[model samples]
Target: MTELVSTTPGLYPLPDWAKQDLSDLKGHQKHDLISGDEGPEIVDVYDRAREEVVSEQVDAGLDRIVEGQLRWDDMLAHPLTVHENVETGGIVRYYDNNNFYRDPQVKGELTFSGDVAAELDATSELLDDEALQAVLPGPYTLAELATNEYYDDDAAFLDAVGEFLAGEVDAFPEHETLFLLEPSLVTDAPDEDLDERVPDAIDRIVDATDADVVVQSYWGALEEKVYAHLMDANVDALGFDFVAGDRDQTLYNINEYGTKDDIALGLVNGQNTLVESPETVHERVEWTLDRIANKSFDRAYVTTNTELFYLPENRATEKLTALAEIANIPEVKA
Candidate 1:
């Protein structure tokens, strides 16, 4: 029987109070929230928010405790824009969605100063290594999100981004798993040669850390060719968005090329305001697993198809509670 675990893909929705408090702040106070030069008032707000967010995951009975990424302004671009070498350019659409992010223009050599590690370190104080899971934007996804001006060659830029992120991972606080969210692979599918190049870039990032790496792709499933090459990378597990993507194609890829030892199944819909029942989520997981009955998994994760930031805080909380129930279901474990 596959051991079922409940975890989020990681950018969690900020609670209503945090959103209200953040919105009320203006000028330097707002800027200080992301910058290191925060005042005591601003510091208190963020500390309280992160604590509350992390507590939500624990109270929900999630097996893996994600840092909730409450400090991130934008999931992909925040890490880069914070660096001295990168500049924040004009707002660009985030994939096909209505949301937008400031384009991270790479102005100089890519180097890791600091990103999610600090936030994860603070979260570590609340949870132990057994439950801690760190989240970061995948190297390929970051490369795709940024407007590269530093490196002349695209492949070189990709590798540099990988190395830069690897440096960040090398400094990360102790954790059980590292989730690299790679939504770009689905939203903006890379062509033939690029697909092959991506696995090499991903392998570099994976090679840097001792933590179990899960390369999670969302928004939709990857094409067969993309999926095949991704499987070649040295990753512990591959995550698929069963809620938003081509479920049939994802199952086919697993059956055709085969998958890693463990799999992360995105059964809960992150975008929708409506929450799913535990039984509904269980049924979906059982259906997918039954189709690939020939395969064996050491563990299977229950997750939201995308980041919960798209949904209301209450709805996201409800979604997580349901996922926990589904993981505990006798049939799901059996």
Candidate 2:
């Protein structure tokens, strides 16, 4: 069996120069490459200055990191739109040009599937020198964000997107890394007496992938039952957002995971300019290692809770480097 590898999640936004390139993506307009305020930019990572940032992250010591999610905002801008199983343009909104619309009141085209797959190919090539963990916004997240024109609830939205995404994942295994950003999946499941409707949605989405699926939860930790189910799910990894969440003891629950499953301890802050120190990271890694070892987990990783789009360039670099080193860190014994 292939060993469960480690990696940081994607979207550590680009630096000043790279950011400038993104801010200037006006003509020859990139879409879907990165999500943006309105409509996704389909630009290839190799073609943009942001590619340089991705390359730099790999050089900075990330055993497996992203191409810096150079074009996610652009992709989010255009998001996937599906209407009655047909294609339309897309639903777009503007937040001073930063793409912040997740109104499930309208339906649009769900055509980024091919585009997403293509870019993953490009992403794979961009990281040809180092291992990469490709990021895909979870179907649940995307569905919740969808502008549902005719759909009744978030469930319908997620199911469609899940099927589309499953097809996307089937296209490659070279990514070697796939982190599904479901920041709310675990925190939102309903109690056993009630029907949450989300865990099943998550299951459908994860069941379709050949790639190692990392069910990532940030923002908050739901009831204990929520995470327990997630741990026992068929996914290959569970990402705990230690940076933004209050999920400390969840690390000790590691024994519930499958042999191939991994634990991603998100220690780096991704939404701010505050650069975390390596020593602090080392200390945290020590604690995390102890917890996982107790649970008999041999594979674990570290990354930022969210994308680094909010962090300054230098800080992002330092945190990612520390994470890389931490991944190579030896396992602590009892």
Candidate 3:
């Protein structure tokens, strides 16, 4: 039987109270917060915020829960910027959106001290192993997003980023799923060497963990060659952006290249303010499933096409609740 699951693919928006608390901090204090050296008040804010966000997912009846990633200042660049060996450069726009993230200028070989893993471990204390889903920026996306001044070649730079992430995965507490977000595969197409370079880097990142790995892409569906090469990787599933990307191209790629046993469908529009109804979500899920009927999947996760941080907290919560309801629809579950 195909199991339908409901979950968020990336970061959840910080609650208004948490946002207010952050707004009260000075410039230097904000820097300390991002570096994991936050003062007691800010630490308390994250602790309480994480708990509430986790509870929100549970209360909404989501099958798999993400820890909300309330602590991440920016998705792909957060880990790099926080590292001591990397210097934070000027802001760069995140994809085609108004949101921006600091560029990480790598000054030396990257190393990880398990900062992200430790954050996941904290979230682990709040949820059981069966429901927890870990999230991170994919190595390819991270490498492409940063300004590498250390490594001599792109391949070596990719490997170092992969190793750093693998170390983070090695230290993580138990989790059922790991979402490695790779939006760059679509936003900025890699060179022709994608087949030769990408899979190996991806392998290094997932090799140490037994969790179900999903290389999630957003903003758009990947090009044919990019999708084909990614399909060759060891990941359990490949995610697509149905809302912001070309849905037909995404379906064509899946039907043409085939997919693994598990897949994630981005049915809800994460950036939109208009909340989708359960019926609407169900219809979209059915449309996608119908198009890819030739393939077989054991599990299908119904999720937002992008991070929920773009929407107001209330709308994001509504989106999550709608996704949960869609998963249970008789037509979708069957």
Candidate 4:
């Protein structure tokens, strides 16, 4: 395992290339909109679109980070193939695809090609000493993509889809830990048994993939049972969105979860562009660090909860570069 270093805790921002990619693709992105009731079309993907976006992210040379993202042309959907069945893939009429989004659910092949994996591998190679992290849309999110799949039973599809989706990760080529984004899981569904299935689906993914895993949840606080189940997953890290979740502080104790495992302290805001100051960032970081007695990181980290996807490209780069500088900064002795 290649040793990776920490940015230590400072105000580093999103990568510069992110803004460039946004600019270069904004028009294209704007055109991709299908406008789901939940939000805009920024989340959609354009078949092979990642080829260019990932290329630019790697070229940006923003070490210690991955691109904000490249997925479903619809707004945030990925791994979804285009099809007439809305559950699998439906034309929302807001987005355009080279035909990828035309089919929302993934098609025949459950695996990625060496060519696709090679591109990811190239990005990972650029990480230098840092572990390359990538995001895999969470099972529930994938279930959302199934909105079009029109399955007779949603839960069953979630299970079958979970099994299939796990294969995608088993096939995806990358290092570092991969994040399974489950923002929707932050809250529960009154109708379904999320308590048992959600984490179970994640386990299926874990059992399927070879890389270290990070189960990330945002938007709302996770239920005690859900958090407890995640603790048992033995994942490399757990990511939470402090800004959106907004507890009264000392959130960890509320659930009786200790600092025994890895946790990504997501302090930055992905929805706002206020550009938090370095000192403030440092303070928050040090506060979190103190909680663990500066305990040499049982895999600790700070994250930008969601992507600054809405922010313009230039500003995004400035933020990312600042973050890299902070991460690479040398510790000063008192």
* Best-performing candidate as measured by TM-score: 3
1-334: candidate 3 lDDT, tens digit per residue: 5688888876888899888887786643333455566788778888899999888888888988888877777666788888888988887888888877788899987877677887888888888544889888888899988999999888889889889999888898888888998888899888996546888788887897999998889998899998988988899888889888688899889989898888898879999999899889888877788789567678888899988888899999988899889765775542
Q: Compose the digit string of candidate 1's lDDT tens values, residues 180-256.
A: 99998998878776788888888887887888899999887788899999998899999999988688888888999
Which sequence of candidate numbers ranks them by lDDT, best first?
A: 3, 1, 2, 4
Q: Write down the TM-score of every candidate.
A: 0.94, 0.76, 0.95, 0.69
The stretch of ten residues in a row with the least summed lDDT in candidate 2 is 28-37
lDDT of each: 0.82, 0.57, 0.83, 0.51
Model 4 residue 264 CA deviation (Å) reads 0.7
Candidate 2 residue-wise lDDT, 1-334, digit = tens? 1122436666655456654555566643333332322334424322464467667767767767565555454333223532233333444542223544323334444433454565566667766668666677776666555555655555565566676667666664466667888754544554463324555655665765655677777765545666666555567767777766555545534445322345666767777677666566756655665555434455666677766665667777766676656545454342
lDDT of 4 by residue, 35-64 (tens): 332123233232234444444434444343
Question: Best to worst by TM-score, what's the order?
Answer: 3, 1, 2, 4
User: Can you tell me which runs of candidate 1 are displaced by over 4 Å?
Assistant: 27-40, 128-130, 331-334
Clashing pairs in 1: none
